[model samples]
Structures are given as structure tokens and as C-alpha cells.
Target: MNEQKIFDNIKHALGEAPRNQFTTEMHLQMIKYADNLKSITAKEFCEGVGLKPSFGTEFSKMRNLTQRLKAAGLNTNQL
Candidate 1:
């Protein structure tokens, strides 16, 4: 399925949560698609994940920084 379609399905399945809970649920769902996501840029990943631009930017920053931290052998638990 296409990006929009995938997220639409995710929304249907996990749409009942409050705003913050909804976002967390969405991220958990995205974990299933990690291998597929690795090939995409942040913008593409956000689009695929069906997040609004602002939220997508935050997600992108979180993802990029987390990856950077991991590569630097830093523990994310300190965050």
C-alpha cells in the first residue's frame, strides 16, 4: 500500500487515543515498518507515516538525533 493508505489504516486501528497517546500508538505501529522506513528520508518518512508537517519535523529531529546518539555510543536513556 502507499504511504497515505498505510497511515490511514493505522489511524483506523489506533485512532481512539488522546493526542499524545495517539502519537505514541502511531510510533509503535511504525516500528513494524522499520526496515521499509530505513530507505527513506525524513520528509518521505513523515509523509509515509501520515503526520502533519510540524509533528513530522519533530519526529524527524527525534529520529535523526536518536540515530546520531546511538552511533556515538551514547545511551538514549540519559535523555
Candidate 2:
């Protein structure tokens, strides 16, 4: 492919990146049992799961996903 085409493809791929970057097994657990962790701080969450506090950023994203689910009345609590 041409240089410009390569750049365009890269950009497009970036824009189409997966919506969720929290792909670790712990992250999946966090989503599945979202209610259990929703009320805790990210640091507390990381500590509970033996992860670095720096992972708090990704934990926050998981929280956002659950929050949206709750707001839309899809939470297990709501259902």
C-alpha cells in the first residue's frame, strides 16, 4: 500500500479500536461482579486484587461501564 494509505489505515484502525481495554481476567471478574466493587475507590480495588494502584485508571473505566449499565436500568439490582 502507498505511504498515505498506510497512514490512513493506521488512523482508521486506531479509531476502530476495541471499546474495552480492560481485558485481564480480573477485569472480567470486576465487570461480572460490578456491584461488589462499584462503591470502592480504584486504589482499594487494585489492592483487593493484588494489582498496582496505577491500574486504577483501567479500574475507573470498568466502573464507568457499570455506571452506564445502572443508569440504563440494566443493573442486576434493577432487573
TM-score of each: 0.47, 0.52
Q: Model 1, stretches more than 4 Å misplaced?
A: 1-5, 18-20, 57-79
Q: When superposed on Cα atoms, how far off is each prediction in RMSD?
A: 5.9, 14.1
Model 1 per-residue lDDT at 35: 34
The global C-alpha lDDT for each of the candidates, from Candidate 1 onward, is 0.58, 0.58
Put down candidate 2 lDDT per residue, 3-29, tens digits, no spaces: 334334334443454666434544554
State the TM-score for model 2: 0.52
Candidate whose TM-score is highest: 2
